[model samples]
Target: MGTETETAPLELDDIQAGALRGRPNPYAGAFLFLRIDDPQDGRTLVRRLAKVVHPADDVTDPLTQTSFSAAFTHAGLCALGVPEESLASFAPEFVQGMAARAGLLGDVGPNAPERWESPLGSDDVHMVLVMLAPNRPQFEQTLELARVTIDDLDGITGVYRQDVFSPADGRNSFGFNDGISQPCVEGAGIPPTNPGERPVKPGEFILGYEDETGSVAPVPQPEVLGRNGSYLVIRKLYTDVAAWRRYLRENASGTDEETLLAAKIVGRWPSGAPLALSPDEDDPELGSDPSRNNVFLYGDDDKGLKCPVGSHARRMNPRDAQVVGEIRLHRLIRRAATFGPALPEGVLEDDGADRGLMFAAINAHLGRQFEFVQAQWIGDGKFVGAPDEVDPLAGAHEDHGTFTVPRRPIRRRLRDLPTFVVNRGGHYFFVPGLSALRWIADLAD
Candidate 1:
């Protein structure tokens, strides 16, 4: 974001990918996840959507999402009549040559859904782009943009709204701020990663880790580097703020309860001082300050004792854990929103409700960062220290039930963890390039 621009054609990293792939302004939005069904399915989707799609392994090229796919814009939708070849490559300099080809030109409209900035990072384009507008005309214009995207895709897998305007104060259910701590891609500042942590290894985050047998863990064999694509985690988290608040009001917070509990659960206070450093008060200003939001970690303080052993902040990203403990570059670049109805004045008088966050996590490894955080730190009682229970905020599990601790006198235990947050639904989806979409569109069922 600083004046730094790549002289060479920069292939989009996770964070940067989010910035380049969307139309400038959208009134509404949605996060879409797609399954190819099989390897052949993956290949078929590639043909039609190739223009906007980028392959993960194309790390060096820096195109949106490193692949090609349809860009839902009014003009783009209008251009459907144009030749696919022309729209395939958006390089203006090459437009002349592309236009010269047959089946490359089409009718572009007054509003074409083009890539402006994306969620994961700037270099990549988002899978879905929705618009929310002020008036009906605007709505109709944006609806056309959405229509273009819908027409191009296979079908809607799942859809959920994310925001925090009252009823949707927090995540719908997964607990904690879903996209609160993602790392910004080198170029496009996104979910904002750990401040001092080194930039993730070039392809290390997206590509699957190699094993003794040279086989990747999750799937995709021949597409080895294609494994370069990040594993996308989408979860519908419903927040029960009333419940979250009720527990706090009733329980005594040992002076550090209210704020500490929040940071412990969110891994950081609203001010951004990681509980690792400032564990006591909610530095509202600090947490609110973008520059200082994610500034500290386990090492800033001399003893690293500022944050407790199992505190969410420490468990989430023990920056010094690499030096003292075994925590690695477990940062996830999240892109999500808070959703649901706004709490009425009456509800506000009591507490917010029917609100939650839609979590869209992008990471190279699920078993590591995403899953590990949920299991070890959030769900596991033995995360980084002795006798600590799961993360009070994000660690609610089905089989394991609620995990609690007595940080003060060490007498607390997880009571039936009143379902403050609920996991409505979610899944893993792959966002291919625009070219990939075209390939699929041309597919015969």
Candidate 2:
């Protein structure tokens, strides 16, 4: 670990609230993608956004108001007249943009950006506007405020927008508990929700700080532009809930067996109880307890007797489990929300409407953290001792995907698992620090 820096008061006023804070309520969330029609006029709109944008210091401010955050795509910065030399200082993957590396993240064939719903990979998308509130009305109120600011600017064009919020019981579209495991950033002063996990270096999630390697991460050119900033990867994933449930039903017998099969595949019960502790059945009590739910490690279950080694949870975060690389190097601060309505009670047929998750992962080093997880961990199961296996929940399976469940008598092998989740589209965004926002808005050229 890096030598600890003096714990000074973080510039909450200079950091965007979303990069450091979790959603206060489960009711409302939305995103807006915009294109820069004119550079100078867009900067004028940005200046307006800066004043109303939410800061990390929300506790003392007006409590009833909604929260908003803003970020830019690489092209957005270029459109705003940020110099080419300055832009070159950013990470290559980000500059190249998410669309260029879609195949590496496993968005190929049917799931490629060409088939994406809207302005995801196109040059048209330049900026992203994020809004969150306690309810729909408040959310819209906040959205309108942003809309009104850029209204008639003749500098920006609305490309696409999507609203996302948490479903009941913290379950995703797949009927399993989501967002249970998240990393804590050291010195961010945010209370650690998962008790057992140690806090990672702030540099892992924010700029101008030492990372787990005990070294400061490289900042983009012009110190103010990169300081306290972090890379944000936003992905729109569509889940085939009915198809997933149907597969389990066909493979396993009875309710009891079906539940177990689902648990094995995800490495957690529907209630979020990890198989590591409550191996046999779902324990809602343990699952709901914040202090206990995320406390277990894979030390005792290296062979995956309790949780399958290649299961979704284990692969995403192999806590204390033996792994090939430095675990801390690839950690991500995940802030995700489910979109689209849930399918009816027992219905296992296609609803046809779009439904999935608006996933956002924040980290300082985009390549080492978010991209590494997607390319090496989520897309491949070989590192965790499962060769040719992919994450059952998120992998873009082109070939016959398989998952092995260890049992006392014999191991159960799930073969030919169809792709359960598909990447509809996504992008690499630069969530600037508040100072950067000011610098951007004030640019002369």
Which candidate wins on TM-score?
A: 2
- Write model 1 residue lDDT over 21-85, tens digit each, in one string: 22112122344433222333333334434433333333342211111222221122112332354
lDDT of 2 by residue, 54-153 (tens): 7877763222446688989999999998888889989888899999998787789778999987788777889898887767788878878887888879
Q: Global CA lDDT of candidate 2, please?
A: 0.84
**TM match of model 1 to true structure:** 0.59
Q: What value does the lDDT take at residue 344 in candidate 2?
A: 77
TM agreement with the true structure for every prediction: 0.59, 0.95
Q: Stretches of candidate 1 above 4 Å error?
A: 1-10, 13-16, 19-28, 32-143, 151-180, 184-195, 208-228, 253-264, 271-273, 300-305, 322-326, 342-353, 386-388, 397-416, 433-445
Q: How accurate is candidate 1 locally (lDDT)?
A: 0.41
Measured with C-alpha atoms, the lDDT of residue 184 in candidate 2 is: 80
Global lDDT scores for all candidate models: 0.41, 0.84
Off by over 4 Å in 2: 1-9, 60-65
Candidate 1 local lDDT, residue 168: 31
